[model samples]
Target chain A: MNIRVADDLTHAVGCIDVTHVSISLGEEAEAFEAVSDLSFAVTPGEFVCILGPSGCGKSTLLGAVAGHLKIGGGQLTVDGKPVLGPSPDRGIVFQQHTLFPWKRVRDNVAFGPKMRGVGKQERRRAADQILQLVGLSGFEHFYPSQLSGGMQQRVEIARVLINRPRVLLMDEPFGALDAQTRNMMQEVLLDIWTEIPTTTVFVTHDIDEALFLADRIVVMSARPGRIVEDLRLPFARPRVSDLVTDVEFVRLKRHVRGLLRQPEKAPQLARLDPLGVQEA
Target chain B: MKVIRCLIRGCSVLSCVALWQLASSLHANLGVITFRNVPPPTEVVESALALLKSPKLLAHVGSSLWRVFAGYGAAAVAGVAFGFAIGRSRAAGDLLLPPLELLRPIPAVAWIPLSILIFPSSELSMIFITFIGALFPIILNTIHGVANVDRRLVASARSLGGTSTAILFEVVLPAAAPSIVTGLAIGMGTSWFCLVTAEMISGQFGIGYYTWEAYTLQNYADIIVGMLIIGVLGMGSSWLLTTFGQALMPWRRAVETR
Candidate 1:
């Protein structure tokens, strides 16, 4: 399907192709501005992490890239086309169990293509492929509530990945997991990224997670959030915990901690104006 | 294990009846309230068996069943359709629900006089009264059920490209099925209670009419038999509906999906 040209908002004057985009939701509130003109981009097949504290509009920015939120004041485009709304080209896995409870796990995975009116056999084949990829092949007939939280989220990932989007948007997909499960999920994610090498942007609060999975880590200040620093992955692909002990990884981790300690709000105009603050 | 449970249940029920019969026998000579207006256990059994042999009695039972089913079916279909329209559309619900609520509280029997004047025949009036009895419950429950389906699911469906018809059929209807069944069961039970009053007042050939006909003839035994039959039929229909719902809602029970 053709990506329709959408009505331009205030953010739409001139911009290049955007890979990783940022957004703010504080304008909805009366007092504090939740997010600011926070922006970044990743090259094709790049893995990026967005790390911030509890309420840093992390999910909001993910939504902006998913074409789910309005661009407030910054333009975000992928492949030279503006995102009017969510598409099969961009798959998202929410933190919560967004699986349709009425649908079985396999059907949930099949939903994206089924909605696109794909034939039954093709969608089923794709769904089964992703289910195996996520290690949920035997769970095709199970409902969302029947599975454990971690298993449910795996189904969520399988559902999103079935369509093979150009970008994968995950908002703390593993935060709800237990520590052991979270580590396992990271390993699984790294493996999938290695296999597909799709453009993946993951939002999280864990400093180590941001360090471990990302090809580049983008740390943001609190409210009126801005990209404070962008740290490249010093480690190699299919990352393991061994890198957590690496000297470069330890140094990058400390720098991110230092940036988060600063208050959420600073000067929004000066932060991103005239060669914006590259590091907080 | 299930068969054993059923066997235990049957024995328990029989044991209770046997105990009741023994106690009544002990008091029968004393003649206080010992199975006087209340038929003794043996008499109830005999009444059922005797009625089974009688064409006139069985016909009354069949007619009463017919009246309840026909009235309840019409009311359920009309009520559910209107309920869905009103419940799914807030403005329509607001516009229609008030008048229905206002009319709901008025006894179906009170409408008997109005129904007679309005309809061409007493059967039509009886159907109207039974419909009145069943309609509000069906509509109210269906409205609640449809309205209360998970909004997130609906939103997700829209995002995933479900047409309005698909959304309604596949999502809203299944989500609301349990509540709708509950309404139908309750409504079916209550329809009998209402049908009796209609049959007594204006019905020519129903169990309720026969009960009154026996009362006028001073055949109190037949009156009691008719009452007992009415009670049994109502219970039987309701149990049938309950079983049907349980069958349809098996997955719901397992996963708590609704």
Candidate 2:
């Protein structure tokens, strides 16, 4: 399947507009604002990373955008339509272990089209193509539990990408990996993004990660999270692993670090999952 | 190491049998328990061999097997269906769980009288008792499994464009499988236990009935043979269930080996 045609690229979709969006997590009596009036716009095909301290609702914002969590106030829209619930148009990748353990790599990747009633052979073919793109061509029959952490994440990405999602929402997708694997995955992700060119919103706390992968970084304050800065990167496309050591990259990292180090009014809240506070 | 372990286990069982044989052969009488009327191991073995040669053995074994299968099959279907409904939907839980919870604690033996009254035939009553015996473990375990399914997996499935039905079949069902299989295995054991109890009380042609008949006839060796048969059947069925479960969830093996 042609993931993205030249004609479709000219009339690009996947523009995300978050206008004064506020989200409250937990039960009504115990509810607290996770994201407070977070406003940002990601233009079609732009790679935006939400960079923040832990529990700052960076992942929560991504959750709301992906339609897994509800927006309590204001509007969160993708491609000019309200995200009422999850759809194939918006595919999300959690940090780790979200891959279906029972499914083989190919079946897991093919789940999207299978849900869409795509024929078995066609979806498998599509899955293989996407798996190859994510550098997991030979391991299609391996169960998710059989694969390494990095390989599993690659399968996770391939699973999402098989839908040819209009927007890719990643919540610290490489956070669970070791340093070496994380860097390699960053390059691999960039390669896939280059080929697909979907509107991507990645959430990460690592400054170097945000600097290297994102076209624009939306930094936020802790607790009742709101945008502190929306810094644009000057780094060129197809960024190499060596870009993290570049002087400009280091300078931007320091600036972002300073923004995150500001004293919090409230104490650090427990880390909220992308699916919001789980009901006990 | 494995061979030695197996040998030790074999010796342990053999020693137990030897002890029993000595006690029964000598008519050993402890204060609380006595082997005065018990049959020796050799006599029990002879009785088992005689039963194997008799045509009545097939009729007894076949009836018990068929009853257990029918009751356990029904329990499996209903338990899983009820479990999925209760686990996934609050409305279903609120509506269905109260009566089930009330019935869950009542032992299958306790249901013998009521089941006999409720069903039109003794055969149906025996199956109902077996169903009751197996139902709780399967349902409770299924509920636990489905409820404990990682919310992230469901959220990801939904985000990937899976409909409610697709998510249930593709994601939730498979994720809950290992626990369900565990429940099924436990259920199989319980079903056999209940079937034997029901058979003894009401059956005309079952291994349980034969055991009861032997007790009435004072044929001590045949009673021991009947008990051994019941033990073997329970063990065999549980083994079958576990094997079936492992085949269903090949991923669990991968995780364990890794």
Query: For each candidate, what is the lDDT?
Result: 0.76, 0.89
Best by TM-score: 2
- On lDDT, the leading prediction is 2
- Tens digits of per-residue lDDT for model 2 on A15-50? 899999999988879988898887889998899999
Q: Model 1 clash pairs? A: A24-A35, A26-A34
Docking class of 1: incorrect
**Candidate 2 structure quality by residue, lDDT tens digits, B1-258:** 999999999999999999999999899999899999999999998999999999989999999999998999999999999998999899999999999989888898899999999999999999999999999999999999999998889999998888888888988899899889988988998899899999999998988999999999999899989999999889889888888888988988988988
Q: How good is the docking of model 2, by CAPRI class? A: medium
DockQ of each: 0.21, 0.70
